[model samples]
Target: MSATTTYNGNDTFHGWAASAKGAPLVLQEMTLKQWTEDDVEIKISHCGMCGSDDHYLCESWGPSTYPCVVGHEIVGTVTRVGKNVKYVKVGDRAGVGAQSGACQRCENCLTGNPNTCSDLKGFILTYGSRWPCGTPSYGGYADKWRGDQHFVFKVPDNMTNEIAATFFCAGITTYAPLKRTDVKAHSVVGVMGIGGLGHYGVLWAKAMGAKVIGMSHSDKKRDVALELGCDDYIVTSDKEDRKRYFKKMTHILCTGTSPDFQWEPYFDLLKVNGHFINVSLPKWDFPPFHTYDILKNQVFIHGSAIGSPNEIREMLKFAAEKNVRPWIQKYSMKDVNKAMENFRAGKPRFRFVLEN
Candidate 1:
C-alpha cells in the first residue's frame, strides 16, 4: 500500500456537503483515504439522487456523520486506476452504487453477496460511512470519487451517463428483488409505488415477460406507469380497485414508503405463497399486523438490500440489452440544494440526476 493518496493535502476534492443534520449542502474541499492498488479514481459526470440520500441528509436513518456528501447513484469517467485494478481502466466510463467496499474475506463476500457482507465494517456505504483508514467516506456529490475498484463498474456504451446513473442505486434496488423471483409471461407482477424504485421495478418486470400491474395509493402516477410499460394500473385506496385485484399478483414489489402507509390491502393483493418484497428503507417501523394473515395467505414478507457486485454487472447488461432507461430529471451539480428541495417535495417524475 502506498502512502500517496489521490486527493491529499492541498490537492483536495471539492463537493457539496451538509455541515449538520438536515442542513443544505455547501461546496467544500475534502480528502481521500490512503491509496491502494485496488482503488480507482473517478472524475464524476453524473449522480442520481435517492431517497436513501435524504435519509442520510436528515439523519432519519440515525444521526448521520456529517459533513455528509451523499449521492450513491454515481457515473463518471475513470481518471486513474491502481495497479491491481482490472475491471476498468483510466479513460473508461464507470459507475458506482450505494456500496463502495466490503471485507473480501467475509462469508457473504466470498459467496458473491458483498452487498450483505457479514463483517461489522464489511458493508462500506458510498457515503454516510467510514473507510478502514479512518477517513469519512464521501459519495458522488463531488468532483471526484476514489475507492475500491471492485465496487465500481464500467458503463455500457449504449447508455448515457444520466441514464446509467439511476441504475446503480434505484435501478439495482428494485431489479435485484424482482430477479430473485421467477417472474415470467405467466406471472402477474404488481409494482407498488410508481416512484423512483417502483418505476424500475415496472420496467424490469415487464422486460422479464411478466404482466405488470402498477399499484399506487392514488391515481396520480397511473398514466406515467402505463407509459413505463405497466400493463395495468391500480389505485389501492379505491376499494373497488383492491377488490378487483384480490389475489392477483404472483409477487408484489413494494418500493415506496410513507409514515401512514397501509399494508393490509397489499397483502390481500398477493396470490397464495406470493412474495411481498420490500426494498424501501423508511424512517418508521412498519405498523404491526396479525400473524393470521401471514398463516392464511402463506405469503413471504422479506426485505432486500442493494445488489451484489456481480448482480449489478448482470443488471447493467440486462438493462442495456432491453433498453431499460429511467425517466430522469437533471439538474446542474451546482444546483444540488435546489434539487434536494425538489426531492423533498416529491417532484421527480421518476428519478433525479445531477450533472457535473
Candidate 2:
C-alpha cells in the first residue's frame, strides 16, 4: 500500500463547523488531509477568533461550502509529523496560522515568499479551502488539526498559548508591514480602530519604541487605548485637532473597517513618503481618493494580508522578548457559540481565544 493508505486509520478529528450559510456553527467530525510525507498533525490548544470567521460563515467574502470550518490563529502542541518534517517534533509547542501549504517551486516561494505562492491550486489555506491531495481543509476550532508541516511554526519557550494565538495572524499581519516600512523609535505611528488587529498594532508599535498614537471616531476608547500603551490619542471628530496634525505622522496603520469611515482626512496625516497600511477587511469599497494629495505627500496606501512565515518567527521572538501581550478573553471550545455571539457584537476587550 502507498504511504497515504498507511496513515488512513488516524485520519479524522472533530471541530465546530458551519452547517449552513449565516447559521450557528455546530460540532462535526472532520476528516484529515491526505497524510503526505510533509504533513504535521497538531492537538490544538488555543485558537483566536477573527472577524474573518463571521465573514466566511455569512458568505460575506464569497460562496463557501456548507459545514466549512473557519479559524486561522492557531497555537497547539505537535501530536505527530511526517518523516520529512524537520522543524517540529512530537510534543513540541507549535502553531498554524491563516495559511497552511504553498507550492515551494513557485517564484515567490523560491524567493522565500511562499505566502505569495503563484500556484493557486497548490496553496492550501487552513480553512474554506482544500489540501493538495484533494481532501477538505478544516481549521482550529476543534480538538485537533492537520496540514502540511511548512505552515506550522514553533511557539516561543516563554509564550503562553493565548498570547501565541494572536501572533499567528494579527501580530504577524501588523509586524510585517511595520518592519518592512522601517518603523522605529523616531517614527510617529498612528493606529486606527482599536479592534483585534488594531490592538496588536498599538502594542507592537509601542514595543518597537515608536511614538504610538491612537485614532478613533471619538474618546470612548481613549482611556483603554492609553492603558494599552498608546502615547497619544486623536479624536477624529475634532476637525481642528485633526488639521493641526496634518502631515505629522510617519506611519498610520488602519485596522478599523466600516463603510462610513472617512478616508479623505487620513491622507493628510502622513508625512512625505509615509505609509498607511490597511489590515482590516471592511465590506464596503472606499470612496475615491484624491490623486493630487497622494502625489504631493508621496504616501503609500495599500491593504495587507496575513503575514509570512519568516515574519511570523520574527514577531513571535520580538513579542516574547519584549513581554508584549495583547488583552484577550478566553472561552472554552464547547462555549464557542456564545463566544461567537459576543465576537459578533464586538464585545471583546481586545480579542478572543478558544481553548481546547
Candidate 3:
C-alpha cells in the first residue's frame, strides 16, 4: 500500500506558534492554502524543531514576522501533486528542508548551488518568510503544507517519518561540510559539539569510515558520543587533556555555538595541512591568531551551510546504506511550543521531532 493513501484530514488540526514578539506560542487553527501546478500538498506527519527556528521565533537573530510558523525539518506524505511534479507523486512519502523555493534559472540554481544563488530574489524559506505570491509560508507546525515540488524529497522506504524529518535540515547541514572536506576512510575527524549537529557529525563521519573523535567541554556526553560511533571523546575543558590530543586531528568540524571558545587550543589540535570548518553561526569577532598557527601547520578555516539537492540525495542514500539513524525525541505537532521550549533548554536527548 502506498504511504499517502493513509492520510485523512478529517479532524481539525492545531498548530502552535509565537503570535508576536516576546510572546509565548499560541495554538491556532490553520487552513492549507490553494495549491499551484508546481505544488505538492503534504499532510505533515512530523516536524523537527531546529535551532534556526528558535533563533527566528525568539527574534534572537532578527525580528520574526508575527504569526510565524517556525519549523523546517518536515516529513509527510503527498496528499496531492500538481501535474508538473514528476519527482514526487501523490501518495509518496516526502519531506521539505530549510529552503522551500529558489529561482530555478539563476546561475547558482543552474549550477546546483541554489542555496548560494545571488540573484535568486524570491527564495521562499520554509517559514517566517513570504512566498512570491505574498502569502506567508507556514511550516510543518501545521497539519498540511503546499510547497513547490522541486524542494520536496521522497523519503526512503527504510526510514521512519520521525527520523526522515530531522534529516531534512540538521543531517544535511553537517553532511554538506563533511562531503565538501572529502572526509573518508582513515581520516582523523574531530567534531566540536555534542548537540544536534555534532551528534550527526559523529554518526556520519564514522559511517564514512573516519576515525572519529567527539570533542566537547565536559565528559557528560562521553558515553553517548562513543555509542554514536566516535572512536574517542575529547573533553576540551581540561587544558592538559586538550593539549595531549593536540596535533592529532586531520580535520576539526566545530559545531559549537559558544562564542567564548579558545581558538588556539583547537588550532593546536590540527595536523599539518588540516582544515577547521565551522557550521555554527555564533556572534563573535574572529580572534587574533599568530601567523605561525597557520604557517606552521598549513591549516585552513571555513564555513558551510546546508547542502544542495544532489548533496542531500547523496547523504540520504549514504545514511540509508549505513543505517545512520539519528537519536530523536518525538512530540505531537500540537506541542510545538513545548518542544521549542525543551529545545531552548537543551532538554532533548539529542534532536526533537514533532509528529502531526
Please list the C-alpha lDDT of all candidates, in the order they appear. Answer: 0.88, 0.85, 0.81
- Model 3: weakest 10-residue lDDT segment is 2-11
Local lDDT at 176 for model 1: 89
Ranking by TM-score: 1, 2, 3
Q: Give Cα distance to truth, residue 178, candidate 2, Å.
A: 0.6
Per-residue C-alpha lDDT of model 3 across residues 273-339, encoded as one tens digit per residue: 8989988865455578888778888898888877788888888899999989999988876667777
- TM-score per model over all chains: 0.96, 0.96, 0.92
Per model, how many backbone clashes are there?
Answer: 0, 0, 0
lDDT of 1 by residue, 1-356 (tens): 34364434233689999999888799998887667788899999999999999988888878888788999999999987878999999899999999999998988889999999888776789997788988989999999999999999999999998889999999999888888877778889988788889889998998899999988877788887898899998886788887888998889998885678767887898889999999988889988888888889898997999999989999999998988888999999999999999998878988989999
- Candidate closer to the true structure by TM-score (higher is better), 2 or 3: 2
Model 2, 45-73: lDDT tens digits are 99999878887887877789877888899
- Scored by lDDT, model 2 comes in at 0.85
Q: Estimate candidate 1's alpha-carbon lDDT, on a 0 to 1 scale.
A: 0.88
Better of 2 and 3 by lDDT: 2
